[model samples]
Target: MSRRVVVTGLGGICATGANVPEFWDNSKKAVCGVSVRTLKAGDEYSITLPIAPIDGFEDRLAEFGRDMARADRFTQLAIAAADEAVRDAGVDFASGLGRRTAAIVGTGIGGQTTFDAAYLAMLKHGRKPHPLSILKIIPNAPASHMSIRYGLNGPAFAISSACASGAHAIGVAADMIRSGAADAALAGASEALLTYGAMETWKAMHIMSDELCRPFSKNRKGLIIGEGAGVLVLEDFAAAKKRGAKIYAELAGFGMNADGKDMINPAVEGAAGAMKTALSTVGAFDPAGVYINAHGTGTLLNDPTESKAIRDVFAAGADSLVVSSTKSMHGHLLGAAGAIEAIATLKAMETGVVPPTINYDEPDPACDLDYCPNEAREQRIDLALSNSFAFGGLNAVLAFRRV
Candidate 1:
């Protein structure tokens, strides 16, 4: 039989809250994180837009030995989330686990802020790049920092697939245990792309919301950029049981696929294929048993595309399924979106309360589905799926089951 993998602990830091409880409290109330916009450091924006800010991130960074100057915003978020996840998993850090434990994190754009600063320095100061420039801005910096912090000697690297990066990271790490590559793994994603250069890139694409984020609204605008990190501690079920570790939920299945079509446009068949693969792997093919955490970036293209994808996979079953975009509450955390939503799904199972999608005043007819709009619900959920679609036509789906 294939080895079973499960989530032992969860940690997340975002605009909603820095810790799990605070994050949940904000989510449960359907609070909106999108706020007034401002200019990013080293960016020259003729216009500023509202964005969700994560306050006190620097305070969290002080616990580790990483120099603030040597780290990127994405790495900072990763350290915070990974530290909490490791502690929550009841990991004996001093034990040999770090040597055996794997660290896999992801980021859509690594160190855009650092790149922005260094380039400006070249023009203004006419000086050489900073010593840590290479370290701070790479996408893999999060993985390296996490491994160094806890002495994890196992495989460590960052996966980049745009917004789908988090789900891909967690899914691949779970496969590590399934294939005997590692005993335990820390899998997640973090992103801090509020820099002027980052903003300019997205602004050029014309995807920022002028006011608020409305996921399924008929008049929905574009995505609101936000920042945060989320990490999960995964281990083999047999090993966790032997160690007397509590299993939050089984990491039942994962599905990954590429559209092979347009790099930026969503593909209906690609998204549905991943969902079907996940259901089959987890033996949760019975659609009634699953709740979906929709990608729901509040962008017009994403919301509708996701709705059709869900319908295409489950067909009639999609009608009865429970789906919500907690992104409505937390805003979009770019690459961290999937991991944090997975954590939210696990928390919903633990507490029997599915968070609501707030600011749902206007609904799009074309994007119709059971979004659990505007209110939290008490329901017994057995299996749940979190879907993430990213740039470059990458898609990932994860399955979690009540233990």
Candidate 2:
């Protein structure tokens, strides 16, 4: 029989809040994380306004006055968040042994900060970069750091699927437990791509917000880029119950797909495919019984397309279901979006209150579905779906049920 996997702990460090509790409380208030950028020299790149940069963030992490040489901001995020998760899950990796504990973290842009710094240093001084520069710059560095730090003794790997990386990492880790690869797994994604080149790349796309991110709004402008990380502790149901661990929620199902036709644009068929697959994984589930955390980047192309896809998949509950975009409060975390949004979904389940999509001034014709606009609402949701669709037509959806 396939083993059951459930979420025991959640850790998130993002624009919303540092820890899970703080993050959940702030999200309940619909606090927008978008702010002005000082790095761009007065609107420097592709996405200027409403950029979600982490404030008071320490890129250099030194626990005992000895810094991890050449560590990047992205790796720091993973470490911080993972520390919280492992602690919350009550697992001591240093003392524990032979339990098949593992880690699977995801990243879309790995060490962009390290890569940029190395290039500039070479140009300015005409000298070779630091020896650990490459080690800090790899996409898998975050996952590697996590495993080394925690001393997990099972399989460890990194998942990269644009915005879908986090969800894929978590889902795949759950399967590891079910298939006897590990008794538990730490899963999520970390990303800090607020570098100059990342900003320039978004600017080239011209799909960033000028004023602010406005999801499900008629006057919606565009999306705002942000940075952060989120991590989760997933363990076999029997093992967690044996340990008397507090259950946060059950990661009921996961669905993923890519648009075969487009490199930049999203295909509606692929979107529907992912949603349908997610719903089908859990058999005869009612769509209205759950809340939804939308990707809702406030882009013209993404918002409407997402709305239509949801309607098609949940036709049974399209009119009454509550769906909102926490991105209005936390901004878009790119590769980390899925994991952070998953935390939001779990928060709604725990608190019994669904957060809102802020900045909803006017309603878009295409985005006519309910978005639980402008304020938090009281709702006892048992099941919830989080949607994240990224560039290159990558789409992922995860369904979580209250335990």
- How do the predictions measure up, each by TM-score? 0.96, 0.94
* Prediction-by-prediction clash tally: 3, 3
C-alpha positional error of residue 276 in candidate 1 after TM-score superposition, expressed in Å: 0.4
lDDT tens digits by residue: candidate 2, 1-403: 5888899988888987877888888888878787887553224233334588778766435651233445888888888888888889886566563247878888998898877767767875587887888888888887887777777778888888887888888878887888888888999998998887778777788888887888889898888878889999998898788889999887778788888888877777888788777777565655667788988888888888888988888886888788999888888888888899999888898889899999998877899888989899989988888888878888888888776
Worst 10 residues of 1 by lDDT: 38-47
lDDT of 1 by residue, 24-60 (tens): 8888887778787667553443447877769887765
- By lDDT, who's the top model here? 1
**Model 2 stretches astray by more than 4 angstroms:** 40-49, 64-69, 94-99
User: Model 2, residue 60: what's the lDDT?
Assistant: 35
Q: Once model 2 is optimally superposed onto the true structure by TM-score, how far is the C-alpha of residue 6 displaced, in angstroms?
A: 0.3
Query: Global CA lDDT of candidate 2, please?
Result: 0.82
